[model samples]
Target chain A: MKRLRVDRWTGQLLLARPGACPASTPRTALRPAAASRCAAVRTRSTRAMPEIPTDEDYADGTDHTRFPPLEKLPPRATSLPSPPPERALQSAKLAALHARLSLPEKLPLQTLARALVDNSADENPLFNNTNLAFVGQSLIHYHVAEWLMCRYPRLPMEILYAAMKGYAGPAALHHVARSWGLEHAAAPGGEVDPGLLQFSLHKPGNAIVTLGYKRAEAEGLQKYKWRHGISSRVVFDDDFGQVVETDKATQLRRADTEYGNEYTRSLAEKAYANCARAVVGAIYAHAGREPAKAFIRSHILSRTLDLSALFSFKKPTRELALLCAREDFEFPIARLLSETGRLSRTPVFVVGIFSGKDKLGEAAGPSLEVARNKAAMNALKSWYLYSPGEHVRVPSDMLAEDAQPWTPAYIDMGEIIGR
Target chain B: MEAVVTRPALSCCRRAASSAPSSTRLLLNSSLPSGTRQKSTAARTRRALNIPPHPSFLHPNKTPESVASRPTSDEIIFNPPSSAPSVFHTPFKFLPKTDPRRMANLTSNLFASSTTIQYNYSPSSAASPSAETTTTPSPESFPSIEGPPVLKPRHHLTPQDIEQMRRLREQDPVTNSVQNLARQFQCSKLFVLMCCQAPKEHQQKIKEQEEKVKARWGPRRRAAREERHRRMEMLFNGQL
Candidate 1:
């Protein structure tokens, strides 16, 4: 939102040494890269190396383009799996993207360029968006969670998780990134524009696990029908309320995983989603809290996802009855509102659920049972999807300048526990 | 409207003509000239959703101006392809609150074919999410084919009454069917069915009757029903 500053987002990445990036504690030690030799400095010594201790550049055989914009590159710059950090300053596509996003003028092109590089493209954390994406993921998760809880206070835990995934999950964020009109390079190379999202479909990205804890039986959680409740999911699983796939087991399987499969589509989605998170991370890292929240609000939160469409009731009438019993409401009784063509083919019946005089919901169906089920579902949706208001104040609103003193949002007791 | 569009359409086409990659080269991911945005054209040997290219893809990408050229006719009205959304019509719910689009949507009902022929898609409904575009758009949640329902929801059934009703229905399910029991107890047929599980013979009888009814259905009606069933399945799985 501010005018361009000379030393903004670039301060962090600009200071980063080319050869001596932090190789500390890799999740990639298990997954082998086909181009592992390009980033030889990493595969050789992740632990042995100190950060920026030496200025020695790892050299491979190929010549790389350097100065004057026409010269063939030398080995030092081109040999690395991804482009040199200095290249970010000169990239036209990177500059175009920054302008397109209307990103804070404080956010530098170099950090934005770094955000384009997936960890799979370049194992070096300095080159890739891992650190930035980690920060962005947390910020995004926090903002989305607070907004959902505040806006729709009575959402069932199951539905809440579903809503979270619909808003902030990799799939949703993938669409967000796509909407920004970003283009991805075929492969990661110094020759490619820094503006293009660079990733290797052949290799699984070592996306840094930031939000969730790794459970002991994480492998068994997905397999063997191991049932974990919503509370445990909050504590142990990822922010999307799914089992955290940060375990070594998933990573090991991911190594042999080829591109263009169903699994790899999720992998591509993760790559694009992390790219989005990296941009948000870059913003927060530069412009502080308020601008990042503003960006998320204008972009991600503004997308349309009908929350009512997410509900999948096994037995809606039963669930509505249970809900009424829990809330100390009057007993629910379905009444026939209307009917048509009763003696003819394709008869229609209209049913409504009532708790005393209050009409909970209504629907029309081909039969009495179907109509009643639909009405019950509608009533439950109106109950579960209750909103305080469209612009309800989330907890983060308190962090704004000249903000009102905290007025607590409505606290829902919880979803009905039913048999 | 067509005159307004031709100018912008020419400029957009010029951009496409000036420096566009050959169709084969675009797919091959041949080393593109630097700064020329060759989008995610690489490594897409396989895709989960093999979406067909838009009919308009053969031509240059249409600007908003080009969309204005869409013809209006009194006799034979034009509708956008179901797969593709019309550029002129954006559902009010999707637009950001600060968008300049709100003013335009409110002033004109884009769905209206011409000045003489206004579709039920009123400008009021297009401007707000609560517009009465469909039968069940708030106020009248439960709708009938003819008109809004005259009957209202009420609650008077007791637990003891429900218990007695259940016993009587269970005793002679054939004689005390759901519809008969509902009339006797002054409750909905759903309540009668909910309280007492229908006996196997009754359920079998209903299933056979449904099959007999289904047998009379034309191919088009049967296909529609099957499509609906599949849609519900997909909706429950949250794929929709």
Candidate 2:
């Protein structure tokens, strides 16, 4: 098999094969001193070619029986900062990870190895997973957002944003990468195994592998805690419906400290998440969309999240009343359905909110007032939680060849009232 | 046989519905002027039939709900068949009954109760020592001889009202208990306590009253309160 090429933009070492033509010189010019050092190594290696083992000799048990002596190079020897592409084939971890994910045969080990390298580890775009991660992030975010929109059609903008963060956010993706048993290299270098996730914490790169429009007000968002309207967020924010801030430089500076800070931890998390995204991107690029989607479904979408817990209502009763008014339904009335130990310190009062004769929602609380409030909240939740069915088809389902005719999914008129 | 009978009935109903609109339109035309009649009839018919205007038509944007009927029932319960297990239930079936994770999953489910379950208290059980004192009082006898009224407190006190409350509290601290002052001013007991400027002696007395109240609480009650407070703190801190 032809050995993988490390792109020259990385400023890493370009090892020359003994028999390879001298015409295949490095594309980018090295420093004058580094160029002289490379020329010397090349001439010496060519003269010592007779002593080096050939491919055929290594195939037999002769060289494998005894440990080979380590070759010591000069301190200034030029080499790839991250593991070379040639090492991808020998990485047992990479092979095991490939098998564990059950990726298609079409996806080669080289692409998977490249996916493990973060932009920080190798700044070269051609070598790092930045481009692959961008593609993967889009795919993941698209699936996540469409699924969320279809499943919970009536989720308020805030809750929807929270749910997106809970499922497809950096923290969530980091959790996914961790759960897959993918270990990170202590520090990124040519010596580290290609299987491990490689990213440098000390020398961070500006690898914002996300599709989002950085809002005009993004600069002041963190500094002032500027109020961003939900409408604007949909237009300007990332897939998780958050303002995209370009603060990697500040974060990198903070990460330089010996003791790991929040910024450093988040940087690591982003790197791991990007690696996971890059894997998905590599799969999509090789095996096509269907297999990539299936891989995502099994690994990411299958995890359970309680969407109801995302809700935080300020005045549920008022909201319910407004919803009823908008729908032209009967005004909701809270009635005491049941109670126990009414005068006791720990009384349990069950209240039901009803619109006309139909019971909207029911809840129990320590006091009647609290029970009534809870019942109102439940009523609002029930109204908001209307789902056609669990098997409701999303927009992407139409992408399949044999997909049924597109049926427009149910869409609500957003929240009854915004806070 | 049922299909044969229902088919004719359905056809007759359909025919009646199709013909009624035209007849109404004709009636409207005969009674009114040409220009005003067309506009009035269309508006009247739309309202009477509750039919939304065509989207392409030059009309005001109608409420989305106007085109769709509201759900008759508030709750939509989907119960899976007992014989065949649902895909939803399959994920949790692997967990053993003793697993605390299973308990959490069950509690966080849509129908989980917010209130604590009262094991000792039941509606069907005979009146216990606490039951008689806890009987629901009539609205007229809200401030019953047994206890204070369960009315919601209002907190719209003016500056003058606060002054009056302070004066009342200072004159007779013993008589003006926080509860009594709260009831009088239609405010929370805590609010009344915060607003009042009691003398040093009165503050000492208030401390003693607080201790007495604390002593009255049973060990189980105290423990339950503490547990509840701890849980609330954990929830607020996002630790739980």
- lDDT (tens digit, per residue) of candidate 2 on A1-419: 97666554332123323222222322122113233221333334333223344445233333522422123122321156787665555466887888788888778877998999999999999889999999999999888889888877877888888888888889999999998789999988765777899998898878779868977777788889988888888888877777787757766666776568888888789998998899999999999989988888898888898765566666667788788777767666676766789888899876766655445666677766666666666666666555555776889888899988996776766778965
DockQ-based class of model 1: incorrect
Worst 10 residues of 1 chain A by lDDT: A63-72
Give the Cα lDDT of each candidate: 0.67, 0.66
Clashing pairs in 2: none
Model 2 docking grade = incorrect
TM-score of 1: 0.56
User: lDDT tens digits, residues B113-208, model 2?
Assistant: 212112223443322233323233222321212124334444478999999999988899888878899879888776887898788898898799
Task: Return the clash pairs for model 1, or none.
Answer: A63-A73, A64-A73, A64-A74, A65-A72, A65-A73
Candidate 1 reaches a DockQ of 0.04
Single out the weakest 10-residue window by summed lDDT for candidate 1 chain B: B110-119
